[model samples]
Structure formats: C-alpha cells, structure tokens
Target: MPKAFPDRASTGWHSHRRAQLLFSLTGAMAVDTTDRRWLIPPRRALWVPPGLPHSVTMRGRVDMRTLYVEPGSGVDLPSSCVALEITPLAQELIIRATEAPLLYEEHSIDGLVMRLLLAEVARLPTLPLWLPLPRRAALAQLCEALLTAPDIGAAAAPLAQSLGISERSFARWFISETGLTFGQWKQRACVLAALDRLSAGAAVARVALDLGYDSPSAFTAMFRKTLGISPRELGRAKPRTPIVAHG
Candidate 1:
C-alpha cells in the first residue's frame, strides 16, 4: 500500500510510521538526508527507513509510486536510505500500484511486491552524486555561501581566499574531498536545488533561468541526460494516496 501525491513536494524533514519505497515511473526525483542524498530516476527508487527524517524533490511531470510497508513486512530491509535500481518488474509494480485505486488494501500481491522491492533495493548502484556538504562549522558556513549563489564566477575563489588558500589550491582540495571536480560539484548542486524548486510546483523556465541555464531547453536537456526524463513528465504525474496496513 502507498500514499501518492502527484506533482508534489515531499514534506520537509519528516518521517513516517512505516518504511517507504519511493520511485518515479516517468521522471527523476531526489532524496536527501541530513548528511547524504541521491537522485532517483527511472527504474530507480529510494527506500526510506521508518522514522528517518528526510525529504524528496521531484524533477518534472514524474510518474511516482511509493509503497508504505507495514512494520513487520520489511524487517530485513536496510535501516538507512537506499537508492535501488528498479528492474522492469519493479517499475511495472510501482506503476500498477499507483493506479490500483485509492482504497486498496494490503493483499497477497502487496507482499509479493514488497519482497521483490526489498531484493532490488539491495542492488542499486552507488552514485557519486551524494557529496557531503561540509559539516565543520566554519567550512560548512563557507560552503553554504557558495550554495546560495553558485552561478557567480567568483563564488569558490572568495571562499578559498577566506580560507587563506589560492583558488587553484582550493579547487584541488574540493576535488580531493568530494571526488568531483569543482565544476562538476557545482553542477550537481545546481541540479539538486533545481529539483527542489521544480517539485514545489515552480515553473521550468523560472527554475532554469534561476539556475543560470542558457534557456529552458538547455536545462531540460541537462536534466533528462542526468536523470533519464524531462521536467514536464516529473511535475505532472498522479498523486499517491494513503496505503492501509494489514496485520
């Protein structure tokens, strides 16, 4: 069973009574914890552990399905958020579950679906996109400044200056720490931020312009390449209704 909210932004920093399997059938989405995050696209889902504070951001008109498993049903599941590679079977299950009517109950099929989901959840590839956003007080503050205005050409340079290092040296340090070039890291950051805005019912053109993209088409191309779907598809999908739990 599941709760669906189409073209919707996830509740901020909250958790649920049951574990949730979050996937998009049509577009891409993002899931974030305090220290970790990932992008979930077609045939990919994020298993959110029960009572774990997190949030999801959809990219475009996304076809999404979230299965809310009861307490005992997922006892063997991982305790942390997992990015699962959705198999064709898993994808079909999500899509079917989403359209299975608002008042559906936990049935034999739900158990079968949950079991398969747990198996696939263990198989998702670890993407490099989930970089740490510096947690040290001073460094985190510096990073926050860069996050707020990523398009400014001198964004990183100023932080490096404040840290008493040359821009080149700072760039190298960022790469060393994040396993991503400075430019790549900034692009990921922009994409993640754009996901949040787009999920919250913001317009594609507005988000693209705000992210400093040349145009909406350019942004859509980037988004599609990154997550395997367009923004329009992510934002306009059907809603998730509350799933009932069975004993």
Candidate 2:
C-alpha cells in the first residue's frame, strides 16, 4: 500500500502474518522491532519477517510504499528484521509494485513486475542501520541505563559486578547477544540516541556535547562514517518521492 504520513506519525506496535517490505519513497522512517531499531532513510528499505512485532515512525512528511508478501512466496528474505539497501532497479520496481492493485491478476504484467521486485529485494545488500539490544534482562537493563545517562562513564567491570557475573561472561554475552562489544555497543547506542534527537530537530553541537563527543566535528565525522551524510543535511534534504508508473 502507498500512504503519506505526517512527520513523526507512527503505526504504534503491530504485527501481521505476511512478511512486509516497507520502502520509504520520501523522507525517513524509524522501524522498531523487538530487539533492534533501524533508522531507514530513503536510500534503504526495511524487511519485516512474518508475525514479528514492529512499529514505524516517520521522521518527516513521509511517502511510504509498503508491500506485503504472502507467507510463502518463494522469497528468501531474512527471517529477522533488516535494512536493505535499495538498488536503482529495485527502486523502480518497488514503485511499480506499490501502485499495482493488491489483488492484481497473477498472470498479467503486474504479476511479473511484483515477482521481479521480490527477486531484486531478496538479493539486495543490507545496510548497517539496525541497533540490537541484549536479550538478557539484566544486560538489557544496563544498556538502557547507559543509553539514558550516557555521561555515566561506567565501565564494564562495575556493570558486570552489579549483575553478579564475571567481566569475561558479561563481555561474551554482550558480544553474542548484540553483535557488539561493550564499548562498541555503547558508542552505537550513543550515536543512535543522538540520531533520534537530531531527527527531531536538535542542533548538532548540542547533541555532540550531550552524547560526550569532545566536539561537534568529532560527532559529524562519526555521523558521516555511519550515515554517509552530515547530520545537518538530514533536515534540509527533501524526501525522494518515487515516480510510480501509472496504469
């Protein structure tokens, strides 16, 4: 389905039986899954596996194109939520797919178009937009605390002790559950939290100091490395609305 959402509008938390490919045709979106959250820009699409709880929040006035794939349509997308990089070919096909009728004839040109879109989507590369959390309650709680009071400067030793585990075990759990070491996950958490503020129109310098970055330039460098664009441009860039081919 194709829908336009006002800035910051959200779908709240919901799930469905069919897998979904949510492509942002304009503006940006934040897709929150059970343990991970993804900041999906126009350059990316988010794949949600069947029955996975998710919520979508628009970053600006957003034109969202969503395709619900049948539970078993032969597409081998990731069972977990992922941010897929949108190739130019896949981008065009997505627009076509979004505009096509939901129950269009399977043997017609629309059918072929949708099949090709799925094929392209399946093979598309992924973006590193997902921020995963620990599944363990204690570690998850620590991560939440760290994200909230980022200035705590608490080391893993203290956190591990508080959790009644050895530092070695805590490190292993952190890496295994979140796919990031304690320090790496902390940095990622700070960056992602900064992104939430930045998208909501916070100034760059203020976010930088708040997140413990020594200077705005340091934060900008990290943002550039992660997002491939300066955070300042996030507000100024117009959402890219795909030109759907009309029947």
Candidate 3:
C-alpha cells in the first residue's frame, strides 16, 4: 500500500540490505547525503544505493511509494543517491509492487512484475542539482545561512568576509570540503530552492521571484539548461512506452 508521511524526518543512516527507490506521489521531500542533498518533487524519485548513509526530510504532505529492491536487482543504478524522472510506466510498477504481496508463489504475476520493474529502473534520468555543503565550521555556518534564506544572493566576497577569511582562502576551504566550486554550489542551492517552491504549487514567476531570479523567463531558461526539461513537465508526464508484458 502507498504510505503518506507527514512532517517526518529519517534516521539519516544507511541500510544494510536494501536499495531504496523513494517516489513522491504528492507534496515534496528532500534527501541528503553527507556530501550532497536532493530535492524531490512529485513524479520524481530518489534511488538510494544500499549501505550509503542518507537522510529524508519532508517539506510538506508527502505521499511516497518506497521500493526496497534486493541488493543485486538494481545493478544499473548509481552508487550514490540521485533524483530521477518518473515515467508513467515506472510509476505504475512502483504502485503495483507496493500493493502486491511480499512473497510470490512460483510463476506468479508479482514475480513478473518485479522483473520488469527492475529492467525499467535503469532508464530513469538522474538530475544534477546536488547541494554540497562544506564541513568546515565557518563554511558550514555559511551554508546554513544560505539554506535558511535560499533567496539570498550574496556573492562569495561578502560570504568570505563574514567567515573572516580571504576570498581565496575561503574558496580553497570550500573546494576541499565540498568538492564543488563556490559558484556551482550556489547555483545548485538556487535550483533546489526553486524545485521545492515549484513542487509546492508555486507559480514559475513567483518561484523566480523567491529565488532572486531577475525574471521568470531567465529562471525557466536556466532550469531547462540544468534539467533538460521544463519544470511544468516534471510530475505530469505521460507514458512514452507501453507495458507490453504482464504475468
């Protein structure tokens, strides 16, 4: 059955045996690893590699379908957590799998469903909006401030000053800690905040304003460049391929 988690936070640890596919059917959620975080909206799922430490945070009412695949079932998936685009067929498989019994008899429909589902798992598109927070005390504080006010558009110089370090020193510290450039991490933060707001049903124009975009068109253009699709197409996708086989 589908589970709806409202205002919940994960233990933020790794699991031993299961690779999880967490899809949001309603509302929005964010998943964070020690190094990176992803914001997941409806029609999107996050594939978490087994034994990788991570945490899930709910932004609002979250309806999620979580699939715990056997260790080797999702071999084509990445070793790290990634936000994926959910096709209609994949969406149906997850919902059906969740509704089916855990154990299947030999030659059962459930077994076939599981097999087909595994094949489709490799086709999901992993987006690149990873929020990498630096671990240094001062830099981490800087990240926290930006996250707390996602619309804040302060440049690196000001941030460096606030951290009481030369801009070059702060840049080196950020690179050492997060493996992302100052500009790259900032862009990701803005996109993630935009995703969160849009998933909550905010209009694109309004989301642009909230994220400090000069205009909605500019924000949409950037989003398309980063994700290769419009934000409006995220959760409302139709099936590109039909399910041809079922047991």
lDDT (C-alpha, whole model) for all candidates: 0.66, 0.81, 0.79
Worst 10 residues of 2 by lDDT: 237-246
Instruction: Give lDDT tens digits, candidate 1, residues 9-117.
Output: 5657788998888776565676678866666654457787778888776565566677776666634666777666455555666766665554545566755565665
Top of the candidates by TM-score: 3
- Candidate 2 on 62-171: residue-level lDDT in tens? 88889888877877768778888787788788888888887889899999999888888889888777778788888888877886666414589988999999999999
Ranking by lDDT: 2, 3, 1
Q: For each of the candidates, give the backbone clash count.
A: 19, 0, 0
> Which residue ranges in model 1 land beyond 4 Å of their true spot?
1-20, 23-34, 38-44, 48-80, 84-110, 119-129, 152-155, 236-247
Per-model TM-score, in order, reads 0.60, 0.76, 0.89
Which candidate comes out best when scored by lDDT? Answer: 2
Candidate 3 residue runs with Cα over 4 Å from true position: 7-16, 235-247
Higher-ranked by TM-score: 2 or 3: 3
lDDT of 3 by residue, 1-247 (tens): 4788776545466564778888878877888887777788777888887787787888778888888877765346666677887778988898888888877764798988777777787877777857877777878887988887776366889888987889999889888998888877777888888888887778888888888889888888888888888878654656656567666
